[model samples]
Target: MSKKILVILSEWGFWGEELVGPLEVLQSRNYKPVLCTPTGRRPRALPPSMDPGYKDPPLGKTVATPEMAEKVRRLDDPSNPYLANQRSLKAMLPERPYWSDLGELGYPDERGQMKMSYYPLRKWEGYCRARAQAQQALVEEFEALLLVGGSGPMIDLVNNYRVHDAILAFKQADKPIAAECYGVACLAKARNFDDPRSIIWGKHVTGHPQEYDYRDLAGVLDPETGAMLSREAGNPDRWVNFGPPFYTLEHILRDATGPEGGVHGSVGRPHSVIVDYPLITGRSTADSYTTGEKLVEVLEKGLRRYGW
Candidate 1:
């Protein structure tokens, strides 16, 4: 059946194959992809991902092909319709208000001059209702959510509550959720306010392993300004390393999956793609195509578990 997939990309940088692999597969079947970013800006592909000679440090193999590189260039082209229009997460999703001094959570202090905004019950009820409607609208409009991986997700997608809400919406609606590389961390972090535990707390998955992470050299985005250090300022190379990664995705997945669930890595295999019911995850860049195919299987073939 023809379907629409919600694709969340990192504005900072997204690995090229992560989007192309699954996208080509899904598009072949007439599936439509709706792309969005943390902000409204177009997503850029990591330069290393567009270089046919770029080899993964651990795997010792070239990760990007010439055809894949060209595809990334096409998608990145401003004239290309694929990314010309992008939905903004900030505009589309309702953000949960900070409660410490929101005035609704407690009796007004020195700063609480506005009486109209002090009704905690009313404020909460309104937020809950809006949140529910937003989630409902999201599920109704999209068949599934696919988060493309890159180091950039470490900067934006993982802890973004709006993204978490998007995940919760798909889960509530029983739609499949797929992520590759660092993008899988979102599944590990998406939790309910009441539960506190991750949605994938007991679900097997795969993501960027600690071993695959750079030990010293890493691409670090400036937290406040989104400006990354030079490949040599704002003028730096896209995938060039600046330091060490903030946190390892594999470590996060290991703790997130808990004891019952398992985390798989492609230590010896060419690719690692795990499907545990509603969630499908890929180990790293190499597994992009497989991750998309697995999502298709979940949506079309009724497959539930795979790559255990």
Candidate 2:
């Protein structure tokens, strides 16, 4: 039987192409990949930011092509058996909301229903449930875990106790794990660098550079609850903050100082891109292809050595 790989996706919005790219590579190698979300139901993709607007190369490049987007939509349709199975790419989209519906915050000036800014003031019910499901799935199936990145990650994965718990459980098992961009933020919650229990402690990994976060307006928040997206309408802040930026670099810098030291440095002058064992990470959408390529190589090498 092929090795089972579990992919965790956030329902918030557009997942980077890297998520799909790595899965494709794994399938080509005959690895069985399963997509799990907060809920077993189909999750919606965040609409392309560039749609019905300006058409540019880089923007067009990152946004899902109409065909790709359409395929995802079809998978959500009840009749799509390919998506009904656990292995379909659509299975990875998160179905359940991490928080209760808050109802429309307000209507957009243009049209469409207004969306909620934050979870309906509930503490962490939705997140807790989702985390339990993800952790249980990881334990019952899958030899490896791949946490994909997207703007939604900033809201759902970072500092969220459920995500923290899932990572903790998988790390304890010593399973091969990989993440990129906002997905890397999940590692920060694993605790201190010296704690053997911490998955990121000594591992070399890369994620959205601080520069990218700031440039993209990552952590800025609304005046009301101090939440990141409470202010925006069409786009919620949940996909922006990925938890306080403080948590992002805290564990990373500590790990970089470890024995490997100089082997891991910032990717560009601004200092993006970091890597460590059993873990491969990247900066942002720009680094998706390279990130996917590296992850495949890592998994292949590991499988070869262990005879998987």
Candidate 3:
């Protein structure tokens, strides 16, 4: 039977090659992709991703080629079926139940003193029911989940609990989860409330390194919602100077993996893709296609672990 994969993108902006590179491999392998966003808005590739002339400051060279740039534009175009057909995470996933909504087992007393206890009844029960239903549906429907990367993830994905829940659900199902660049940060932040340690706490992974990070970041501004993407919307003709990445991916991944695990970046190698079972990761744009291929192998060839 053909498999279906959930391909998530940042509504603000995604890097051109990150999505296009891996997506092509999946499609070629007869894997159906269901493109989705945090809120269903059409995700676009960053302006720099669409410009072949845009030089990567950190890399100190031209990154976007004309052919790749064109592909990104076409995929992001609303007229195209890919961007036109997408799902909203908000509508698909269930929200977490509030701690204060424990019914008879909760709520403070009139004296202003706190009075609360833990119980699995009332509203909490109903919430758990709905949450179970949603998580089950996702796990049964998709074979795996892929989070495409870019600067936009810093704003829309890193702290998104909806995304966190999805990651947790997939992990519980023992399914592979593939992420690239900044998207790998999502794995670092997706953790259980009780444990707190990231799921990748003891797994080898790859992510955008501190050295690859840009000293001066630029992002696109959404005209409608005024959300920042990958560039300045006002200054379309030129790049605008803005704050760099919110945090370094290498640092976050290193800390998330702790002393036991490791983070392999492109310190000496040109590309880095690490597969520690159900957790496949790519260092940056250069590793996109390889990450996708490794994911396919994990599914079809019984490949368990790769790259420490």
lDDT by residue for model 2 over 1-308, one digit each (tens)?
89887776664543535465576678777887776554443333443321323132322334455555554455444576643354432232222343456653322222233333454533243433444455666666776777777666555556555455656656666666667667776775555323554455545556554434332333333223323353354354245443434444434544543554322335454324444555666655545555555556666665322101
Residue-level error in angstroms, candidate 2, position 197? 7.9
Please give, for residues 155-177, the per-residue lDDT of candidate 3 as tens digits: 78888988988898899999999
Ranking by TM-score: 1, 3, 2
Off by over 4 Å in 1: 103-116, 119-121, 220-228, 231-242
Question: What are the Cα lDDT values of the candidates?
Answer: 0.82, 0.51, 0.82
Which of the two, 2 or 3, has more lDDT?
Answer: 3
- Candidate 2: worst 10 consecutive residues by lDDT? 106-115
What local lDDT score does residue 217 receive in model 3, on the 0 to 100 scale? 65
User: Among these predicted structures, which one has the highest TM-score?
Assistant: 1
What is the lDDT for 82 in model 2?
43
> On a 0 to 1 TM-score scale, where does candidate 3 land against the true structure?
0.87
Taking the tens digit of each residue's C-alpha lDDT, what string does model 1 give over 114-209?
234555554555556667878999998899999999888988898999999999999989899999998999998999877978999889999887
Steric clash pairs (candidate 1): 218-242, 218-243, 230-233
